[model samples]
Target: MAVASLIPPAPATGEPQSGCYMAATSDCGGRLSREHYISRGLIDGPELRVRGMPWQREEVARFSPDNLVARILCRRHNSAMSPLDAHAIRFFLSVEAGLKHAQRRSLSRKSRFYMTSGDGLELWAMKTLASLYSSGIEFMTPEHRFRDFEPPMERIVAELSSPNPCSIMTLSLPLMQDAHEEQIGRRAVSIGPIVDDETGELSGLLVRMHGIALVFNIDLPDKDALPETEIARPDMIDLIGMDRTSRIFLSRAKRRPEAWIVQIRLSHPRKDPPAGRSDRGCNRQPLRK
Candidate 1:
């Protein structure tokens, strides 16, 4: 189930046409170019493993990161998304580094904190969702459905490109639970959509990577809707059982005025795909640190 207002409906059948999905937007121009719906930076080395996508027998297979590209956005629109991709890349890199440090025997509590632009993270999520749709992936996928629907592409684009901040979605982490964390392999990544039980509209998107999982809401709720004290609305479904997110701001301290702050949150143990989420065998080499 998708929220109304995606692309224009076809003249004969009234079905949404996938042709140049972003044609209606003013920011779209230049030649149609390949866009990595999923940031290539998220890929380490040359490839990454994916599961739960149709066409795979075991629901798991490795593909070169470049294979994820699609001729979705025009060259200009796609290039405009570079900053968001960089933010997301910095975030994952920071996560890998922090995780390695956390496992160190002589870890210090003070070293756990990090920071990045929350706005950039949110934009990354929106960009990811738009790219998926533009790449021919439907919002009403087999894994999650109510009624067939499509999102308002223009609105998603406007929200993503606009300068003013908006609460399009929230990213959250599970409250700790190593019992489940230990089961999820660091290379695991899962994504699925969510539908509103009542409205039957595409409500959110769930993305689980490594041990941590995050959900990005689809409705684009008001930034002020979430009071500073609350992480998520009680009525919002716990799509990934990891919704405890809160906003934080920091000021430069005299001790490390030159250093920037970034917050790295990790979660694990959510339900894995049909393929399984167990750690890789000891004989197999890790994809990356």
Candidate 2:
């Protein structure tokens, strides 16, 4: 494949519908601001690398965290939603910290532990989806691209501004890998639209990078029989709460990984593991025969 240098965002579209793309009833009184398309604070590094974008065209693009921003949110709305970014950062960092601790300690290569809130992380993914569409950028890849991506803008605004934002969303771990079965860049994150295959419409969004991968299913009426993901997974991420800032634990391990497999299998439907069993994986895969 080829590597491309990221060009800057096209000049503003000069459209009348400016100000804040994320505002609904709440007024957009605050100054218009550039929202980091990929939340900057979540980078945890001086720079970030992005891949699989329309402009990059199957090429990897490097960016200083600040350079990857888009002017989409107002000061007030942006500030109000700052918590969303924090939540994503927490979830991502927890995964990072857990892995680091395990590596430093020379613990089992299979697993490590960490904590985060599911609801907030979901919102962050939604917010990221909003950013991607609102910026008017589309995936140029034929299969993954959305040329007529009609985003659910109203739902996005309502969910983001709501005091307890929770709407159509499902979380999953995508085992991101190349044809070579090698992990994509794990040091950074990428946000993109998920288009429905049959309808060719925008479905939801995928927020993934490094060891931390999450999918937000926004378009489906219900998360049933989600298409199998050809991505990577962390060993185990057990989410207990959906709408509140509850502490969730993710004790991950390197499972029997293969290229393009959605490794986080929804496990033991509602039933706990056998009492004495040491496993506590909410996202555990069923044992293979």
Best model number under lDDT? 2
lDDT for model 1, please. Answer: 0.50
What is each predicted model's overall lDDT from 0 to 1?
Answer: 0.50, 0.54
Highest TM-score scorer: 2
Judge candidate 2 at residue 131 and give its lDDT. 78
- The deviation in Å at residue 122 for candidate 2 is 0.6
Give lDDT tens digits, candidate 2, residues 1-289: 1111111123422333355775454445456887887888776778777766667754567778888777887765676677767877877777555434433433233333355555566666777777777877766555665647767778877766554466456566643332211342256566666777887777667666653446677644532456444222223343211111112343222124321122221211334332112443323342210
Candidate 2 ranges with C-alpha deviation above 4 Å: 1-17, 104-112, 174-181, 227-289
What is the per-residue lDDT of model 1 for residues 149-182, given as tens digits with 9 covering 90 to 100? Answer: 4656678766654545343666533333431235
Name model 1 segments beyond 4 Å from true.
1-20, 105-110, 138-147, 165-167, 176-185, 220-230, 233-289
